[model samples]
Target chain A: MALIEVEKHEVEEEQKPEPVRVRGLPFFPHFLLREVVVMCLIAGGLIMLASIYPAGLLKPADPFDTPSPIYPEWYFLYVFGFLKFWTWDLGPIPAKMIGVTVPMVLWYGLLILVPFIDRNPSSDIRKRKVAVTLGVIVLIGILYFTYFSIVHH
Target chain B: MTLNDKIYKWLDDRFKLSELLPPIVKHPAPLNVVSNPLYCLGGTAFLCFLILVITGIFLAMYYKPTPAEAYKSVEHIMTAVPMGSLIRSVHHWAANTMIAAVMLHMMRIYFMGAYKKPRELNWVVGISLLLITTTFGFSGYLLPWDQLAFWATKIGTGIAGSIPVIGGYISLILVGGNDIGAETLTRFFAIHVMILPIAIATLLGLHFMMVRIQGISGRL
Candidate 1:
């Protein structure tokens, strides 16, 4: 009876304190003040950039004339880069299919599956060696592909 | 009593403001999160979004979706409309900045393993946000209907159309016919203006709500 009562007390103790409710600055004034300042700086920088380098307008669209070295937006360069890089057919599948699927579908699928895949409960960087290394590799691959698309364009 | 006190008393009687306001007003943002510059990326993206929304509305007030008038309308916005150049230029820069900020924010989240345990769903919503933001870029790219926009979209649609089984359908749905024409322009305009904004707004609400529920994973 005493052992059971002790276990119940221990369970109550574990549940009593909320782990994440650490004391910090109030959100309204202290935190929001910093946010507003940062926001102003960014807003100013954007306006300056806009004034210095206005957005360009090119010649009207002509269906008969296709421009050379056409490219998608900068964010999408990787898709084009991967398409160019992967020219091999895996058995019956075509190269284009592989190229499109790998980057567009497989990459995003892996990203969405990250939390589930890692299964490592630790948030500490020092403890997550494999996750950090893989993340670096993926980042490098994306950067390289983006660079590839630009240079090859 | 002061006028402010009278107003508060009135509001508190009807809406229970006194009960609701204290907890929210006293909520603490983690000290590290407030000090760290890296934590600012998401807010940066959000600020860009707000800027884009304002400028985009101004541009849309003058923009015409038809291919015949699309480029001309954009030209008008740039050269003719009052402060049009600044608005369009700001929109352009904000869109680009938002994309970069979102990417950096995702990297921060990934490195910190902030998506672990109870926050996995928020990560999913975030990836969806990233996808929506890029789609915003893609759909908006073709709005000006210039040589670059047209050809770039052509290349983009061609790539999207090459996906094995459903590629043809996706292409057809996007293009609206055998070729990119008036239909394509109008469709993209609708998507850029209507569909994406609604989708993004909804997802952003969910994303923030989740964050509030889970708190900032501010460790490391």
Candidate 2:
């Protein structure tokens, strides 16, 4: 019975029309040409920027004297902002711990779980209202926090 | 045969390049992806990575990881070594550009919903890549042993050390002691120059392979 079903399925497969190929440019010269152009522009930009404004080197480190208004890299400024922003203690957990964990651990955890959390199966922006809104909110929050860090510093 | 044809034939006979080249050369990249500038973010990050690696290797040749000599070495590279300032500056700019490109690429992926269904694992890999990239910036930031580098790292590590349970260990592992000193410098050097590179390269290989196997997400 299984063999007969398999054979019938094969016959149906044979009777179907050929699948249409996806319309696109070949990877060889056509696709590569655009890539090469973009690469050239980016490289040119980097070289120009480097020539105009070189990287700086400050005075050697003095452990005894701490610099005021010190900050982490720009990417990490949001975390610093959050730490400063979140000052309330939650039950037993310290505010400091919460500040660090929320930005560093929880934020990344949420990011990693994004696919699993939003199972809407739709790629259309119009259809994914919830996901889009949440994403925008998060982006705004990060940007605000980053700004806060700079201003407060 | 001409020299080019002769060389091609020789390589083809030895390595079966004739059989291998067609699939790769003939593969179709979707028309939308080809035309759209949005798809270029990841590639921009990759280009920055390549530039960083090349410039990093040159910078590494002159960099001294020891806390005592680290500042002097970077100063030497900046002022004394031939084209050293240019190379170092390029590395700095590329590092910053790569981080920015990665963030923009993530934003593109998120807003486009490219992380849906079959692409879930690739999204995870991408997040890991972002973490590694930021960590790269953090470790590299301290290499110059300047006032900004020292104090920034101190605050950075202090923040990390404030986390709930495993915070102490993370700080210890990163700093290699109670404070940022010779050990911390060496550890950061090894991480910035060695471990992170190896990890990122492997993850990048897996990331690209998955993209190849699955093909780019079809949605706009």
Candidate 3:
């Protein structure tokens, strides 16, 4: 009976919340100070880069003379890769729907559904193995496809 | 009284600046957030956006929306205007940086599990913001009216044109006609400079308001 009481007490102690630690300096000076310094550094770096390598202005566009293998900006390369990779003998409508519409919808849908789907309240990454694994896999896939588009194009 | 104190009192009496400023100026950030560098990505993105706006305004002063003059205007800016190339390059780099920063910020939020429970709406808003930002890039890409800009936009709109039933309409709306031409350039210019800025600013305000109300998410 005594041992049971002792065990119950220990469990209650474990369940108690830890005291919150307020460790940082006040926002007015400390945080702002750091932010200002970082901003100045970024500005300096940008100015230096801009001076060193000014953006090149390409020739005027001619509708009659089309460029071969036109590609979108770097960020859109993954989408470009998707369109290339999914080129089976599927009809135009089916190809567009399946290759373009479906993947885009699914990607955004997954993003929207994340909070609802992962109900586990813990923020510790290790505790949420499935979420972490999926996130890493998606990241990897994006990078791989992006690389492929760049090299192949 | 000191000169500074006298000026402050004068402004405070007229505008009630003293009463309105404290809450914002003295707002407390969580200690962990202060110490962590990852939390700064959103602020950096905001900074980049500010840079883009300033530089974009300067470029717009010289830029022409017409298909015939668009490329020439850009070239003129680079060659004739004072520090024009530098400003344009900075705008280009900043846009790229802002996109990167926003992406990193989103990844950080995801990994930290900051989008749970009451913060879900903020996540949705954030995703919308990302799409808007990308749209900003896409619209702006056509403004130079160069070979790359023309062809890339043609391909981009072509992708939209491939959508089943409404694809044709969507492409028409995007390009403002059958092909990428004067209409397309003008439409993209309008969206880039006017529509997108207003939309992004409004969404940013809402996102920040939510963050301020909810406070930063705690670590596990």
After superposing the true interface residues, what Cα RMSD does each candidate give? 3.1, 3.1, 4.0
Candidate 3 per-residue C-alpha lDDT over A55-128 given as tens digits, one digit per residue, 9 for 90 to 100 = 76677999988887777877888887777666664554556566676446568778877888989888888898
DockQ winner among the candidates? Answer: 2
Worst 10-residue lDDT window, candidate 2 chain A: A1-10
Candidate 3 segments whose C-alpha is farther than 4 A from its true place:
A1-21, A89-93
| Top-lDDT structure, candidate number | 2
Estimate, for each residue in B1-220, the C-alpha lDDT of model 1 and write its tens digit.
Answer: 9999999999999999989986776677776786689999999999999999999999999999999999999999999999999999999999999999999999999999999989999999999999999999999999999999999998888888998788899899889998999999999999999999999999999999999899999679
Can you tell me which runs of candidate 2 are displaced by over 4 Å? Answer: A1-12, A15-19
- Cα lDDT computed for each candidate against the true fold: 0.91, 0.92, 0.84
B199 Cα displacement, candidate 2 (Å): 0.2
- After TM-score superposition, the amount by which residue A104's alpha carbon in candidate 2 deviates from its true location, in angstroms, is 0.5
Candidate 3 CAPRI level: acceptable
Better of 1 and 3 by lDDT: 1
RMSD per model, one decimal: 5.8, 6.0, 7.1
For model 3 the TM-score comes to: 0.90
Instruction: Spell out the clash pairs found in candidate 1.
Output: none
lDDT string for model 3 (B110-194, tens) is 9888998889999999998988888899998989999989999998888878766788888988988787899999999999999
Lowest summed-lDDT stretch of 10 residues in model 1 chain B?
Answer: B22-31
